[model samples]
Target chain A: MAILELKDIHKSFQDNVVLDGINLSVNKGDIVGIVGPSGTGKSTLLRSINLLERPEQGEIRFEDITLNLPLKGKERKSVTALRKRIGMVFQKFYLFEHKTALQNVMEGLITVQKKPKKETEQIALDALEKVGLKAWKNHYPKHMSGGQQPRVAIARTLAMKPDIILLDEPTSALDPELVTEVLTTIKAIAEQGYTMLLVSHEMDFVSKISNRVLFLDGGKIIEDGTPEEVFRHPKSDRAKEFFDKMNKLKEPEFFI
Target chain B: MDTKFSDYFSVKLMWSRIPYLVKKIPITLELAGLAFLVSIVIGLLIAVIRYKKVKILSPIATAFLSLMRGTPMLIQLYVAYYGIPAILRIFNSWGANIDVNVIPKMVYAFFALGLYQAAFTSETFRAALESVDKGEIEAATAMGMTYGQVLRRIIVPEALENALPGICNSVIGLVKGTSLASTCGIIEITYQNQILAGRDYRYLEGYVALAIIYWIITIILEKIFKLVEKKFRIPEQPKTVEEV
Candidate 1:
């Protein structure tokens, strides 16, 4: 059964339409990897699900609740309620600079969830431990490595225990040397059977981890299928061209 | 024409006046302390109003900021000291039960100094509030934090930390500003020094002693602020090689 359904989602920045009548359904425990060229609205689509970038028009049916887009004042409460169930991780990590890693993870739990302080601490610590950062819980983001910061960000989002997690180019901002550790942490999270929608430029990593692949171009999904089908047997010319370009970039001569 | 330097400088008198001048320090501090408290509250309010561009209140705050910034501090002190009682007397005439005569001069001093300092500190606070990374706010919002929660947890703590240096400067400025309270006969350190000088006619010595006292206070405040900044310093990532 579909746990989340987005119907006829349309978003525009004045004259430039970013998401053009896009429709998608995400089932429980599905790992959907979205790949597209920059500025193709992959991030916007992910953001729209949580109402971070409110779409001009859409109907979001998540579990039993339905939220019509361009939310009215009365519907705003539901939007906040909806956001609680859909967690987002940004490319830049966005860890609270004033907080320690444990505090960062504990913040939403304490403030939003209103969990007891003692219980929240244990939950936050466990989340940190899951990301392999239990010992570094007291460290602030700046004191930690770029790789470690995103792992803390992951812990922050995980502590909320959202129904679906959205990762938007989670390793894009990291240095090349730091990318592997964050990816490894994310891969570990995926193995725990969390439902996730990931927009990534890491083609090999996405293909390895995601059961489903989506190819977006010009604010529309050009191809959506099993990872093997999209990667090895793309039906659309755009997908084929995109994958070919991606494959060519992997060649050692391309770097030189 | 053979006037010795001793004619103008009275080191002994200046030393003797220190204890009397020091006794008046509390009054100066009280004025400054009350004014500082008022500034923090009003300054934060004005900053929030202006920063959020609150519909009706924002323009009023802007006008207030302009009035505070454009006018001289002396003019504002006169307005607070004289103009307030004038306005209050009108309220008194209409049976408001306010005793304009009984109101303390220090209250007026606090009002003037606080509003003036608040104007500058509001700008400082607004800039500090703006300096908070937008991404962190978004992260908090994405995690289901309400706007108020985002502000209290993420925005304010960071803004306060960033505004520390600016606030310290304002405090020093306000301490110096208390000297103006003598215009209303509030008998603070400067007024007490003037009284001592009036008796001895050692105006230069008295003024020099007052300057020394203020200089020492400024130095002490600077040291305190430095310690505070160190205590609250957020560890920053080392700048990248390219940035360096």
Candidate 2:
């Protein structure tokens, strides 16, 4: 059974259509990777699922509730409540500059979840341990390297224990060496069978971690299949063209 | 103007008399401190109103900022201390029995100075709030934080750290502005010195003592604010120590 579904999702900014009627469904523990060229509305489609970018028209069913968009006060409250169970990791780390890694992870639990201070601290420490940031939990974001900072950011999201995680190019901004640490952490999370919808340009890492890969083109999903099927035998002309172009671009050493 | 200290220009007498003027420093401090606290609250309110651009209240806040900043503070003080009573008297004769002069002169000076400081500090607040990275706010929202939660957790804390230096400058300005309270008969440092100069005719001595007191206060305030700014400063980039 599908744990999350977006039916006929449509979005546009002004007269420019950013997303056409797009449909997708993810069963529990499914790691769905979205890969596409820039300006293809892949991020818009992922963001629309969480209602961060409201769809012009669509019904998104997550677990039980159908999200109401064009979000008003009551709808907004429900969205926020829903968001508590749906975590998002940004391309930029977005770790609070004022907070330490441990404090950053604990902030949501204390403020949103209303968890006890002692319990939140223990959980935050455990999350940091999982991300290999246990020793640096007390360090602030600016003081940490770009790669280490996203680990803290992931630790922060992971501590919330959300049912699904959305990652928008989690390592696109990192240095070459730094990307390995974050990709490793992401792969580890996938191994634990957590639900994730990842939008990334790292084709190799996406293929390695995602059970199913989706190719989005011109605001629509052009192809969807297992990673081996989509990458090795893309049927759609748009997908073939995208893969050919992406292949010509030099890849980092980690891709192999 | 004729010099009042020609006959009583004894340096020893001047040194001895300086202590008397120093006695009124507490009153000057009280006036500045209370007015500064009040100004900060009003300033934050004005900034939030203007920044949020509330339909009905934003324009009013803009007009208010202009009006406070446009007029001379001395004129504003005079209006609060003198004009308000006269207006109240007119209202009293029309059947209301409220006493116009019941409020103290110090209160009027505090009101005038605080309102003036708010005008300046609100601009500082707006600029600081706008400087916080927009990406941080979006990330906070995506984490399921309510708008109010995002503001309290992310926006205000960051903005306040950025606003400190300017706000401290305003606080120091307010301390200096407390000198004007003498005009309202508050008998603060400046007023007390003027009274001493009249009696002993050592006008230059009284004036010198008053200047030193203000100079000391400014130095002390600067040091205190410096410590505060450092406490809230963002920690510099993390230095890595290689782990074996």
Candidate 3:
């Protein structure tokens, strides 16, 4: 059975249609990469899956629960439960500005799971250790670099022990040298067998890490296949053009 | 021509009022303090009501804030002191025998100041609440936190840090505004100054003394507010958002 499945998902903002008849399915332990040009609703699709953005029309199923619109009541409860099964990371690390690194990690455990302080502290510390931020446990996000803050954010989600993880351009905001460190941590996490959905512009990382690659253009999937199949030989003219353009472009050392 | 300088800066007049007026300062502070505390409670309740958009009551709260903000504070003081008593007297005449005087002038002052500032305080709190990032709230909610727990644990504390500077300024304004309560015979600093001036015929000195006292109080308050702001400031950090 699929861990997550979406069928005919449709959403539009004002007059601009962002997602039209979007369909996707991911099995457990799969790592899927979504790549697209700017303004192609990549972030919107991820947010819709989490029910942060309600779709105008669609069937979205995660495990046993299905949502046609944003879920509420028992359905919302299950949605939250499903979210616990899914960890999410963003390009701009959103750490609680007021909390220390350890406290930020512990927040979900103590507040959400109603865990005792001592136990939550232990769990949070372990997660921080996993992210190599154990020494900075007492430090607030303000005192850390962008890369360090995102690592803490990752630790925060990992503390929740989710079954699947989502990375929304996770390293897009980092400096070039810093991007490798974050991706290396993610690579390690993937090696540990966590399922992932990644939206990224890092074609190389997508080619390396993805079990399947999805190319989105103008809010619909243009191509979906293995990296070797899509990167080596392009069936679509748009894919060919995009790949050629990426190759021809002179990206700064820090940006790519 | 300048021989009547004693009339303007009479030590005798100012010294005589010192003991009596000093006693009255406490009364002013008491009234202002009580009113400020009450206003905070009323303001927080109204803010929470409006923030939640609680159906029928939310609009009522908004309208109440509008009325309080629209009218002059003095008019509100008069309605509390005079209009309320007159309505009570009408009830007394019908053999209800309600002694409206049982409610003192200080109570009227407290009500007038509290309700008025509550309107502005609610706005301050609303702005403070908005300063809290939406992600914090979402994170708490995903963790299975109830709305109340999220507010009490995460939202209110963060909002307090943001709102503190404005609230401190408002408290200083409240202290100055307490002078209006003298019109209703609350015997505050302004009232004592008036009484002292009437006896010694040195009105300027008495008013000057009151002005100095108020200035001192506010300067001290501003220092305290700065200290509090420095201590409680939300540290500037790169704002990060987690995806889950």
- The top-ranked prediction according to DockQ is 2
**What value of lDDT does candidate 1 attain over all alpha carbons?**
0.92
lDDT of 3 by residue, A69-90 (tens): 6445567666666666667786
Interface RMSD of 2: 2.6
In terms of lDDT, the poorest run of 10 residues in model 2 chain A is A68-77
Q: Provide TM-scores for the models.
A: 0.94, 0.94, 0.88
User: How is the predicted docking of candidate 2 categorized under the CAPRI scheme?
Assistant: medium
- Which one is best on TM-score? 1
Question: Mind giving the per-residue lDDT tens digits that candidate 3 earns over B195-227?
Answer: 877875778878777887889889999999899
Residue by residue across A133-174, what tens digits does model 2's lDDT show? 888876788888889988898988999998899999998998
- The collision pairs in model 1 are none
lDDT of 2 by residue, B1-244 (tens): 6766545566666677678877888898899988998889999999999988889999999999999999988889988988878888888899889876677888899999999999999999999999888878877887789889999999999999999999989988998898888889899988998898888678887777777788889999999989999999965656453351
Number of backbone clashes in candidate 3: 6
lDDT of 1 by residue, A178-221 (tens): 88988998999999999999999999999999999999999999
**Residue pairs clashing, model 3:** A93-B240, A93-B241, A94-B240, A94-B241, A95-B240, A112-B143
- iRMSD, per candidate, in listed order: 7.7, 2.6, 8.3
Query: Model 3 off-target regions past 4 Å?
Result: A70-74, A250-256, B45-63, B87-98, B134-150, B234-244
